[model samples]
Target: MAESSPVRFGILGCANIARKVSRAIALAPNATISAVGSRSIEKATAYAQENGYPSTTKIYGSYEAVLDDPEVDAVYVPLPTSLHVKWAVLAAQKKKHVLLEKPVALNVKELDVILEECESNGVQYMDATMWMHHPRTAKMKEFLSDSQRFGQLKSVHSTFAYLGDTEFLENNIRVKSDLDALGALGDAGWYSIRAILWTTDYELPKTVTALRDPEFNEAGVILSCGASLSWKDGRVATFYCSFLANMAMDIVASGSKGNLRVHDFVIPFKENVAPFYTVEDSWFGELAKSIHPAPSEQQVNTDLPQEALMVTEFSNLVGSIKGEGSKPEKRWPTISRKTQLVVDAVKASIEKGFEPVEIIY
Candidate 1:
């Protein structure tokens, strides 16, 4: 790989999310789409054409073909949760860096296997948590870290929900027991859990207790659920995710001296700019008649969409390994594992009739 050449990415599926990511790869200056694969060669070819992939982009009938392509330096895996471990490990074994979709695995154990394969093969691995790459997220982190403004965190709450249509409720792979068994927890709650952990700098909670009476489909798949996480220092966080509510994505964090709120945490309502709210040193006037200084709005602008930024970041890491012979970045895989670990704990708590599950790591 030449220093001047862009990192070559091979997409492993024609999943809907992959369409968005393919555009991001095209937008990223450091990356380019090299190939796309599906079980059906015609589908792969059509996807490439429909997504405006370059004429040189290869279309393959199987994921293995993409991994075997010498020109491909990395693979973007948008496969379902059940297929992630197999394809991700195979990609790593082929020495191709992996950019995996969110809810990276069915469980932490599976995640560990994927990570081990990537480590042993010296390939970069990153989960597609695009919001982490957003400029607004960094700005919000700065506010949260300010001791004078935000003080010590006391509590946090996050929610992500979207009402599913009849077709989706009946046919979506997300609700399929054999495909995405984790259901809404893995799809929507993954973002909420990651957001909560991000506020605490990825610290594992001491315990997790799922809210009682989770709704389920006929196949025994979760349709809606919530959980509470408690830290040893008394910091508490709660999150809810569902496919039975109007679309909403929010995170509210309260501290000793300040509070923060964001209405759009998963995907910004707008692609170019994102806004958040915060209030510092809030107090009431005499007789609690009036509040002093209302919450302020902060907006951050981006040159490219967050997903593109994510691709650029992952591609940069792959480029370093390919061009400079550098070691794979550990930060990505570490955060991904921590997120999965917490997710598993929440699922365990639900299975145990909402009993509190202690987090070991």
Candidate 2:
């Protein structure tokens, strides 16, 4: 509640996502990792130690214990999609601000309840969507809004896919039976929806439909589904997501005058190839060059730390909460609305045998 105070963040899980976010929280200004909770105390303590966090950061055996700590000013929930709503509401009820990861919940109904709880508690509630906070997306939005580059926006097509490990498959929470609906749609595919909604000012279609292959791994939990989202203005966007395959994770936007193609749009600049963009007069004018991998100068394997964009953004939200006026509240209404709409549409399509369903927003 104090204006000049640094916000204390207590993470709810020690999953891989948590490691990346924790690093981000450490880098962001005026944010501190006061505590971290995991299902195992040893795991929590080890994570805290390995990550260079203060030893004073208490390790809790349960998430609820972290929420109950008076020192924790805000909570970050990176649990499975179905569990998001339950823990979010509980955090709000405890009077803690929340930065929940994507999908927020499995459906609109769950999200509505979480939103209601936040409103009732008078606490800040945000979906932890780093793409929305990235500068590249802002540039994309600018180009999409310009009349010359984007007049009468016609279509948006996106693909988000990656391969999963079998060993990880053995112990991962993602493969659990209790979290049936928390798959690629709720995970990576949510990025496609976020992109279209944010770039198009949340003008989406009334109907949506999906086709999926159920034989895959994460696909079994949440299928690799593609959807055709039809807008009221006759503008349609196509979306694709998969956890069983590897894709470039590209997002292409087509309009009347010109088109924009972004490869690795979701994790753009996070790793691998440098996150730099070069604008060209035409997309087809580009040539692909294949270079053979040169042998390493040293016969040693190197490790690069993971990206913490989510945690950095969450910390910024905390700083905003302590700031005079936060713009995320006034500006993020469209994000919240569109997220629910896209999620609802996708779930409906999956449940009805990939039938075309209408979006209420």
TM-score of each: 0.99, 0.83
Model 2 clash pairs are: 205-230, 205-231
Clashes by residue pair, model 1:
none
Off by over 4 Å in 2: 1-3, 168-171, 212-220, 269-313, 320-334
For candidate 2, write residues 16-60 as lDDT tens digits: 777777876776555678999988999888888988887789899
State which candidate has the highest TM-score.
1
lDDT of 1 by residue, 133-227 (tens): 99999999999999999999999999999999999999998999999999999999999999999999999899999999989999998999999
Of candidate 2, the 10-residue stretch with the lowest lDDT total is 294-303
| Reference-based TM-score, model 1 | 0.99
How many collisions between residues are there in candidate 1? 0
When superposed on Cα atoms, how far off is each prediction in RMSD? 1.1, 6.3
